[model samples]
Structures are given as C-alpha cells and as structure tokens.
Target chain A: MRPRVALNIKSVDYEFLQEQFGSKSELLLKSNPVHKKIPVLLHNGKPICESSIIVEYIDEVWSSSPSILPSDPHNRALARFWAAYLDEKVPLFWVITAASEEEKNAAVDQLKEVAVEMEGAYGETSRGGDFFGGDKIGVVDIAFGSMLGSARAIQVRVGVKLLDEEKTPGLVKWAEKFSADPAVKDVLPETEKLVEFAKLLSAKFKAAAASDPLRR
Target chain B: MRPRVALNIKSVDYEFLQEQFGSKSELLLKSNPVHKKIPVLLHNGKPICESSIIVEYIDEVWSSSPSILPSDPHNRALARFWAAYLDEKVPLFWVITAASEEEKNAAVDQLKEVAVEMEGAYGETSRGGDFFGGDKIGVVDIAFGSMLGSARAIQVRVGVKLLDEEKTPGLVKWAEKFSADPAVKDVLPETEKLVEFAKLLSAKFKAAAASDPLRR
Candidate 1:
C-alpha cells in the first residue's frame, strides 16, 4: 500500500499484481526467494522485496516530485527509526481478538503505549501539519499511513477504538489527512471489505491462541 | 558493532557507551525509549536508534570517505536487502544449543541453508575480492561481520562449524577478511572471552528449551 501511495504521489505508472497468501505466484517466489512475500515491486524485471525497501527503491528510481524519505541524513535516520517503531509496535495490536478478554485488553493497552510514544516521536519535527516527517507525506507517514487503513478495519471488526482522539489527537489528525490524501485513498481497500476480512483473520487468531499449548 | 565499524571505517572519533542488558541507563532509556536498546548514536544530542540506521547516519554525517552503503540506488536497495536478511537469518543460528541433539542438528541445517543463500548473494558482486558490497567492507559486510565474530566463538564452544568451507567458500573467505579488517578487529571482543560467553549462553538456552512446555 505504501509503495502504491508513493508511486501515485510521484505519478509513476505501474501494474499492480495482487498475490494470494496460499497461492503465491512463481514470479514472487523467484523474485523474492528470501521472503516470498507480497508488495514485491517488480521493476524492469528486477524484484524489490520488503515494503520499506521497495518504497525507497521507488523514491530513488522516480526521483521526481514527492520524496518519501527526507534528504537530510539525521532526519532520514529519525524517519527510519519511527517507521521501524511502527513496524515493531503496530503488530502487537493484532491480538485484539485473543482468546481471553484480559489478553485483548492488554493488547489495547500496549497499542495505547505505542501510540503515546509515536506522539512524542512526532513532536516539533513535523514538516507538514500533522504528518510525522512534517507537512509532506514522508516515509514515516506512509509507514503509519498504511497501518492506519487496516487499523480502521480492525476497529470496525473489534468494536474497539485503538487510536482514541483524546489520547492521540495528532495521530487521529494524521490518519484523517492520510486517509483523505488522493493517492492514499486511491489504493485503500474498502472499509466494509476490510471489516469482513478482519473477522476471518481474528477468528483464526483466536483459534490459534486457544490451541496454543504454551498459553497459560 | 556495525556502527562501531562504520565509524572506524570513516575514521570518526566518538565515545562508546557500553549498555548493560539487565539494567540499561536512563540516558539509553530516554534516548531510545521505543526499543531501549544500545548502539544508539547520539550526535548533537539527537538519538539514532537501530544499528543499521545508526550506520547510515554515520555514513551521511561523515560523508567524506569510505561510504558504507552503495551510492547507486539499486545497489543501495540490494545492500539493505542483504543486511536485513542477515539480521533475520543469523539469529536462528543462536538456537543451536537446543535441548535435544535432533533440534541442534536442525538448527545447524538451518544455518547451512542460510549460508548457501548468502554465498549466492555474494557470488560475483564482491568488490574487495573477499567482501560483500565489494572489497570496501560496506554495510552488508559490517552487518555479517558483527555476527561472524560471535559465530566464531560459538564454533569454538560447540565444536561444530556452521560455516563449512566446502558449502560456503565465499562466506568463509569473506569472514576471514572481515575478521582481519582493522576497523572490525579493533572493536571485536577477545575470542576466548566470547567462547566462555557462548558456553554460558548455550547452557541457558538448553535449560530453557528443556523446560519449554510446548516442546513435545
């Protein structure tokens, strides 16, 4: 999704290849033998795996209008830092449908803690109003922007709000602008379909947790 | 360690703040509250967390000579890919001290598989005759170089060579050059001390695996 938003922002034309989890294409397997995961941007026969790396590749190749990553090295590091934090911390919110309510509540609290840290990370350094890398949608914005789409679906599915307006007003505002961005909205999956997909995923997660022998 | 090597390669003098795992300093905790891990480069009081990010920061700040990352965007992406691969795959080798011989053998096999892929990655792309990212000890070299140091110690303790010369001659050669590099050797801990450390770590791993309720 980030790669798509980046491409769209740069107005770079490319084909989108949707890959199913169980039936991944031979191209994906061949292009990304290491991970064999999706968002493998195949450009001129070369495949770039990993979402963040792919986005960087796109920004480098296009190198035209909107830059995803900042030009300054320190700012680039800080953007990478927050992007990495989002990757590590956002997944903890996936246990919203853990087998027990206590576990679910814990996941919510963890999400809240991560949100607060993200709020601090965005302090006084924002370029654009509300975006992490400031006014423009930089790498960190795309990183969290991609997650916010799914987070909205999860919110609808679980009937629990992870990004509370009162607690994380900045993130809330950023999400609104991010979702409203023409390029971002162009690639976002419909909320209703996402809710349905989330239901299926949450069921599998609950089943896995219930059957986990190590779970005490 | 990669950060240290990058700094050394660039001939940038800086202070080393050793961080204890069990009791991290408040500065570390404050500087990197997200992960609270070390190798946090605080240049001009701004914190750069994550070793890779720190290395990139060093390269950008002291962009005078011996750049760790490739200048080409595509090559840069590839270097980042291999570095990320090392981070993900090398840690699996640490599980070699599993409770059972079967599990230990499985871990060894996993390491061998990772080594073969790494061999292919370094095939004709080497610059420095025996280094990844060519002969210059780039980011990929530092990434794996840091791992190879501990791996040698583990080899001494376990008496099992994970980097079989026949299976991974490229990596074997690369490891030798990496260990011999002045920048790398300057920061590496003593092999004998690392061996003792490996022994203690293996014992703890075996004990934990033995008590693992999930293990059949």
Candidate 2:
C-alpha cells in the first residue's frame, strides 16, 4: 500500500497485480524466491521485494515527485526509522484482533500502551501537518497510515478501542486525515471488507486456541 | 558493525562510544528511545537506529567515496534484499552454536541446508569480486561478512562446522576474502574475544535448555 501511494503520488504508471495466498503465482515465487512474498514491484523486468525497499526503489527510479523521503539526511533517517518502527509495531494490533478470550484483555492493554507511547512520540514531532511526514504524505505517513487504516477496522471488529481519541489523540487525528486524503482513499481496502477479514482471522485463531491443550 | 564498516571504508572519522549494557545512558535512550538499541549512528546530534539505515544515511551524507550501494535501482534493491535476508537468517547460526547436544545435529543440518541454498544463489551471481555486490566491499558484503566473521569464531568455539568448504565453497571463499580485507579486518572483534563471547552464550543457552521440561 505504501508503494501504491508512492506511485500514485508520483503519477508513475504501473500494473497492480493482486497475489492470491492460497495459490501464490509461479511468477511471484520465481521473482522473489528469497521471501516469496507479495508487494514485489517488477520494474524494467527486475523484481524488488520488501515494501519499504520497493518504495525507496520507486523514489530512486522516478525522481519526479516531491520525494517520498525528505532531502535532508537526518530527516530521511528519521522517516526511515519511524516507517521501520511502524512495521515492527503493527503486529500488536493484529494480536488484539486474533487473541483468544483469555488473552484478549492483555493484548488490548498492550496495544493501548503502544498507542500511548506512539502518541507521546508523535506529539513531540508534530509539525501541525495533516500527515506524519508533514504537510505532504511521505514514506513514514504512508507506512504508519496504512497500518492505522487496518487497525481502524480491527478496532471495530474486536470492539476494543485501541486508538481512543483521548488516549491517542495525535495518532487518531493522523489516521483520520490519512484516510480522508484522495490518493490514500483510492488505494485503501473497504472498511467492511477489512472487518470481514478480521472476523475470519479471529475465528481461525480461536479455533486454533481451542484445539491447544495448554490453552484449554 | 555494518555501519562502522561502511563509515570506515569511506574513511569517515568519528567517535565510537561503547554503550554499557548494565546501565545505558539517558542520552543513548533519548537518542534512540524507540528501539533503545545501538549501532545507532549519531550524526550532527541526530540519531539513526538500525544498521542498514545508518549505512545508507552515512553514504548519503558523505558522497565523496565510491558508493557502498550500487546506483542502479534494481541492483540496489537486490543489495537491500540480501542484506535483509542476512539479518533474518543470521539467528540460525546462533541456533546451531547454542543448541543442546540432542538438538545440535538438527541445527547443524538446518544451517547446512541454508548454506547450500545460499551457495546456489551465490554461484549463479558470482562476479569473481569475492563480495556479494561485486568488485568492491558493498553493503551486502559488509553485512553478511560481519556475520560470517562472527560465525567463524563461533565455529571454532562450538567445535562444529556450519560453513564447510565443500558444501558452501562460494561463501567460504567469500568469508576468507572478506576477513582478510584491510577495512573489514580493522573493525572486526578479535577472533579470540569472539570465541570467549560464544562460549558465554553457549553456556547460557545450555543452562536454559537443561531446565526446560520440553527439552528434557
């Protein structure tokens, strides 16, 4: 999604190929045999794996936009740090949606703790912009915004408010502004569909939890 | 260590402060409060966490020397992929080193299998430069080379060979060339010191394993 937002922002023409998980394509396997993961951008017959790396690659190959990363070295490092940090932190949100009943409370508490920490950090760095990367949507905004977008639907499905307006005002406001942006809206998955997927994941997780004797 | 290598290769002079793990400084915590981990590059007072990001930041900030990363986007992506892959796969070496005798055989076999796969990949892309990025000690070489340097010491301490010459000839040869390189050797920890560290880790792991009912 970060790559999509980046390409759209830069107005770079590209073909979007959806990967089917149940039966991943031979091409995907061949192209990114190292990880065999999706979001592999095939540019000029060369495949780039990893979403953050792909975003960087896109920024390098098509140097026309206001730059997905900032021009300054320190700011660029900050952007990359937050983006990578977001990737590490996003799994906690999923833990909330996927945890069994016994674990759900703990998971929600942990997620909220993470949210509070992020709020503190985000508040300290806020430039009064509509995005994490300032007035425009940059790499950090794209990465964190996409995860927060998914977290929104997960919050709804789990009926646990991890991103409360009071507790995480900075993140909540950023999420709202990110979701409302035209380019972001164009690439975001439908909220209803996301909720449905969350439900399916929750069911699978519960089933697995039930079958485990230690949990039982 | 990879960041250190990158900076050293470019002859960038700076201070290297060893962080005390027993009681980390408030400044270290403030510099990279998010991860609170080092190999954090403090350039002009701004902190950059994560080794690969720091390497890129260093390369971008000081553009005098030959670039650590390739200019071509595809090649750059490949470098990023392999560097990331090495990060993910390096833990397997420690697993092999620290596994209890009962698990040691399995761990060694698994590590060997990884070696075989990497050998195949390396053989296909060999450019006779004794490095992953070819001709010069590029980013991927710095990363994997650092790990291999440690692996060599681990191999000596564990009395178990994971990087056998016959099975992983390309990697073995690359490792030899990398360790001998003046820039890389200048920064690598003393082999004897690394062996002592490996002994400490192996003892800790064995102690933990012995107490675990699952392992028993």
Candidate 3:
C-alpha cells in the first residue's frame, strides 16, 4: 500500500501483484531474497523491497511532480524520522488481535501516546494546512497513511477507538482526507473487507501462538 | 559510529560527546524525544537521531569527497536495502547474550546464511575493491562495518564464528579492511573492551529476562 500510494502520487503507472500470503513466489523470492515480502517494486528488471525504501526509490526514479520526499535535508530527515516512527508502530495496529489483555491495554496506551506526538508533528508540519506535507501527501503522510486502513480495521475488530476527535482530532480529519484523496482512494483497502481479513489473520495468529508464543 | 565514520570519511571535523549509557541526559531527551537513545548527531543546534538516518543526514549536509552512499538510483537503493538488512539483524548480535540454546543455534544458522548473502552483496558492490563503496567506506560499509566491534566480541564470547574465511572469505577480508580504515578505526571500539561490555550486558539482560521473557 505504501509503495502503491507513492507510485500513484508520483503518477507512475505500474501493475499491482496481490501476493498470496503464506506461500512464497519464485519472482518474489528472486527479487527480494532477503525479506521475501510484498511491496516489492520491480523497476525495469531490478527489485526494490521494503515499502519506505521503495517509496524513496520511486521519488528518485520518477522525478515527477508532487515529490514524495521534501527537498531540504533537514525536512527530509524529519520526514524519515516520522516515517520510521510510524512504521515502528505497525505492530500496534495488530497487537489488538494478538496480545493478552495486559498487552492490549499497554499497546492501546502506547498508541494513544503515539497519536499525541503524531498529532503535534502533523500540526507542525502541516503549518495549519490539511496534510502533513502542508498540502499534498509527502513521505510522512504516506508513511502513516498507508497504515490507516489496517488501523481502521483494528479499530472495528477490537471495538476500540485508536484515533478519535478528542485524542487526535487532526489525525481523524487527516485520515478522512487521506482516504478520500484521488491518487490513493482506490489504493486504500475498504475497511469492511479488511475487517474480515483481520478476523482471519487473528485466528491464524492465535493458532500460531499456540505453539510459538513469539508469533503474538 | 556510523555517522562518525561517515563524517570522518566526508572530512567533516566535529566534536564527540561520550553519552553515558543507561541514563539519558536532558539534552538527549530534548533532542530525540522519541527514542531518547544515543548516536544523536547535534548539527548547528538541531538533533538527528538513529545512526543510519544520521549517516544519510551527514552525507547530504556535508556533500564532499568520498560519498557515503552511491550516486546512481538503483545502486543507492541497493545500498539502502543492505543497510536496512544489516540493521534488521541487530538482534542477531544480542540474542546470543539473552537467548535459549535452541534459539541461539537458530540465530547462528541465520547469521551464517546472512553472511552468505552479504558476501555476494559485498562482491557485487565492491566490484573487486576492498569496501562496499568500491574504494572507500560508503553507506553499506559503514552500515555493517560499525557493527564489527560487537561481532568480534561476540565471536570471542560465544565461541561461534559468524563470518569465517570458509563461508565468507570476502567478508573476512572486508572486515579487516573496514576496521583498518583510518576514517573509522578510532570510531570502532576495541574488541576486548566490547567483550567486557557484552558480558555485562548479557548479565543485565539475563536479569531482565528473568522477569520478562521478551527482554531476550
């Protein structure tokens, strides 16, 4: 979703491959032998794995309008920092489905704390605008925006509000604006479908955790 | 160490502050409010946290001879990919200190396979040269090179060879070459000192693991 949104924002036409989860593909294994994960961008014949790296690679190669990353070095570093911070909280999106009550409570608290910081970041970077990039979606926007779908799914599945008006009013608005954006509207998965997928994944994780506690 | 080595390679003279481990100061807390960890590069007045991000920031800000990262887009992507890969394996460095025997064996096996892939990566990136940046220590070199001190300490403390001549001949040679490079020799810690630190860390981690299983 990150690379796709990045490609869309860059106006680069590309095919999307819905890789079958739990089964490795020859092409994927060949392209990204290290991680063997999705969000692999095959440009010309070379593969660029990892979503954030692929986004930066796309920005460099396309060199089109609406540059995904900022031009200033300090801005780029802040963007990278926020992107890393958001990506690090990815498990926070799933811990609701995979954690114990104690862990779930802890994750929720941490996520709320993350939301407070991110709200300030969005406020500062937006400069009273609608997005983290002040106007169009930039790296920091795409970074957390890509996870908004999963976050919504988790919110529904867990019957918990991770981002609400009181906690993250700006983020709630940002999420709505981000999902409605023309470039990435089709890219973000529907919340209901993701909810069902989350249900299945939670079950799968529960089974895996039966034997391997670390799966949680 | 990554940013320091890159700064040295870029010929950017700077003061070094030895941050006391365990107890983060107010400056660190103010600079990097997110992680509040070490390796925070204070440039002018702003702070850049995370070693890898700091290295790229230095490369972008300094922009002199001996480029830390490559110029080409694909090559730059490859460098970032390898850097991310090596950083992801950071846990493989500490698992030996706080892991079960079976888990440690699994980590060892995984590290060996990582060595195989990294050897191929080094061979391709170096192109018959000494460092991953071909002639000088670039991003990839600094990425893994900075970890050589701990790896050597682990090799001695754990009695397990990670990058041996039989499995990774090029890497063994590259390790020596990277360590001997004047730009980063002082930045890399002494193995004996690191070995002692590793022992103390292992003991501390064991104490933590006694209460929390995830400490390992």
Candidate 4:
C-alpha cells in the first residue's frame, strides 16, 4: 500500500484539501508549475518533483520504519545505480510503443538492446540474488517495480511483448517478487485499469500525432 | 581541491587507471556501456554513472570531514531537487551552442526560459549565503558548479551569456560563490581550456549534423 504518514491535527485540513482537489489541486499546481505532474511530494509547502527523488525524501523523513535504501554506502550506491538505470531506460518502452510504425520498429530494436543491458546490470546471474542488491527489496526494486506496472500496459497497447519470462526470465521473476511484496502490492494500481489507461493514452497520442503537421 | 579518496595500498594502481580513463575508458565502457560516458565513479568494482549521483555517493561514502549535503531531510531534498533540475536542463546550453544558427536560436530561447525558471526557483532575493544551501558548499552546489563551468564555456563560444548578474542576479552570485570555493575551485577545468574544448566539440557536432540526414 502507498504508505502515508499519519497526519497531525493541523494537517487534517490540508489532507481534506488534498482529497477535495485531487490531482489538479491548486497546491500541486503551485508547487510543480513547470511540470504540473502528479507524484509531487509537498513538504512544508515546498514541492519536490520526480518520483525516485520523492521516494528518497520519504525515506529520509520517516526513518523509523523499514529503510527504503541500504545503509552501507557501496550498497546504497549500487541500489541507486539500478534505480537510475531503470528510470533512464524504461521511458523508451512507452516512447517506442507510441511512435509510428517505422519509429516503432527502431524503438523495438533499441528496447531489445536496452533489455540486454538491463539483464546484464540486474540479472540474477550478475547480482546473484533475488533482488537487485540481494535478499532485501530495496531502492532498486522500488524503482524497477514502479515501471513494471506500466510496462504490461504499453506492451498490450503496442502489441509488442517485451517482458515475457521466456525472454527475460530473471526480470520477470524479479517483477513477480516485487509485486508480491506487501508494501508494493498495497500501493499498485489494478493491472486492468492501468492497461485501459494506457490504451486511452496511446489512442490520444496517436490521434494528436496524426492531426499535428509539426509532429509529422 | 577535488578530494581524492585514498584507496588501500593494493588499489593505488587502480587510481592511475581511473585517472587515465576518460570517455573511452574500459572500466567506463563496461560500467556504462549504454551511455559510454565519463565521470563514472567505480566503488569496489561496480560503477555509478551520472555526475550528480556520483557526488552524492561520494558524500555518503566519505561522511567524515566535510559533508557535501545538509544533514536535515527537508534541506537535503531541496538540494537534490536543484541538482536534478540543473542536470536535466543545463545541457541545453551546450546543445544550443553546438547547433546550427536556426537550431541555435531555438536552443538559446529554450535555455533562457530554463534560466528564468532556475532563477525563480532559486528565489530573486538572495539568502546572502555563499552556496545553494546556507553556508557550506553542498551537493547541489557541486552539481551546478560543474555545469556552470561548462556553461561558461558554451556562453563564450556561442557569444550568448545566460548567467548574467543583472538577468539572474541571485544565480550569478551563487555561481560566483560556488566557483570560488576551495573544493570547487580546485576541481574546475580552466575556463580557457573548457572554451577550447567546447569549440572543438561544436565543430565535431556540426560536422556530424551535416552528415546525418535525420538530424536535418
């Protein structure tokens, strides 16, 4: 489940505002005017953009419970490396699926190459453990896990499957383990809903691409 | 001076390897085979790519004398937000300078917009503080400091200065303070050398752009 810090009495009013305003809330808009994107974590009225960075902020503020990142510097760096690697590379999956047929083909080739690199970077053989780091589900897993939720949607919409067990067995297994985690499982969107959202987004993007001469 | 970690006696030889390797170093090639970029910090044997991330890793690893980041979580998050923002956006300065006149104009406009946003994000009123976070030079300072060095080169080569005191007074002062810091001062490449490097890179990029029909 998406763990939220217990709101104090004063924050109750702000929490109510959050629920009322939803994604397009004035607070979110004010905090993240440039991107105006969701997942903007506002702390003390200042907004921190970007998902992975927000996760790190959360971990820092609430150090009482389960640590999101490892304590050791080397191990933490390794975890962060995988997190960043996933963040940098995984966006291409959506970009590829959203492109025209010719562009899609090129994206497919690029995706395959990236997948190979991912395997080498985080595969079971290389990492020698269930998770990217080892036994625990750390920052790296969280990073990859966030992306996997959307991967299937992109694959289905594009009719190009990239995350099959037969091809990326290690990655497939890791995803399964990550999704099964209590914290992760609680927070994840329903797969069916996510796939539907992707279908809508893909259609919208394709339609926009068709209508826009500049895009063409 | 750029602080150097003294590895164990046996690993001193590897220090030479680190220094010798540039963009094409084998260690860098292996670690960041995808990007094949430099500034990859290899701890033990694993590689952490991305300069900002590497700086954070360095700070976490060497938590002894001078901490590069603030100890408080809120301040730390703010520091990271600026660092990531600079990393993502500042490269446009180089891209603009490296492009053809038409593309160069577009890039310059984009860079100015980003600069405005950065200035606003930094706040118009100065904290009268030396670095990004209050007193000491921190992670955000390191990230931006490195980029500003390159930005100075791009500005000189392209004849379009973006970080002016009058336009972005707070940021200009921040840059000046950051560049003058003992640690940052020692690490920065000479401005003349960086300008020459930028010119060479621009020439190379223009040549490649001419050859690549897709870029056109």
**Best-performing candidate as measured by TM-score:** 3
Error of 2 at A87 (Å): 1.7
Determine the backbone clash count of candidate 2. Answer: 0
Could you give candidate 3's per-residue lDDT for residues A1-216 as a string of tens digits? 889898888777888887786688999999988788887999889998899899999999888778988888888888899998887788776766766777677777777888889998998899877889688899998888887887778678767777889979999999999989988799888899888777677777767766752232
For residues A21-98, what per-residue lDDT tens digits would candidate 1 score against the true structure? 438788888998888877788877778888889888889999987788889988899888888778766556566644
Candidate 4 TM-score to native? 0.82
lDDT of candidate 4 over A7-65, digit per residue (tens): 11012222322322223767777877877766676678777667777778777776754
| DockQ for all candidate structures vs. native | 0.48, 0.46, 0.57, 0.40
lDDT of 1: 0.77
- Candidate 1 local lDDT, residue A63: 91
Q: Which ten residues in a row have the lowest lDDT in candidate 4 chain A?
A: A1-10
Could you give the TM-score of chain B for each candidate, in order?
A: 0.86, 0.84, 0.93, 0.78
Model 3 stretches with alpha carbons more than 4 Å out: A206-216, B207-216
- Give the TM-score of chain B in candidate 4: 0.78
Per-candidate local distance difference test: 0.77, 0.75, 0.83, 0.64
- Candidate closer to the true structure by lDDT (higher is better), 2 or 3: 3
Q: How far in Å is the alpha carbon of B185 misplaced in model 4? A: 2.1
Error of 4 at A48 (Å): 3.3
**In model 2, which residue pairs have backbone atoms overlapping below 3 Å?**
none
The regions of model 4 sitting more than 4 angstroms off are: A1-23, A43-46, A124-129, A199-216, B1-23, B42-47, B124-126, B203-216
Error of 3 at B211 (Å): 5.2
Error of 4 at B39 (Å): 0.7
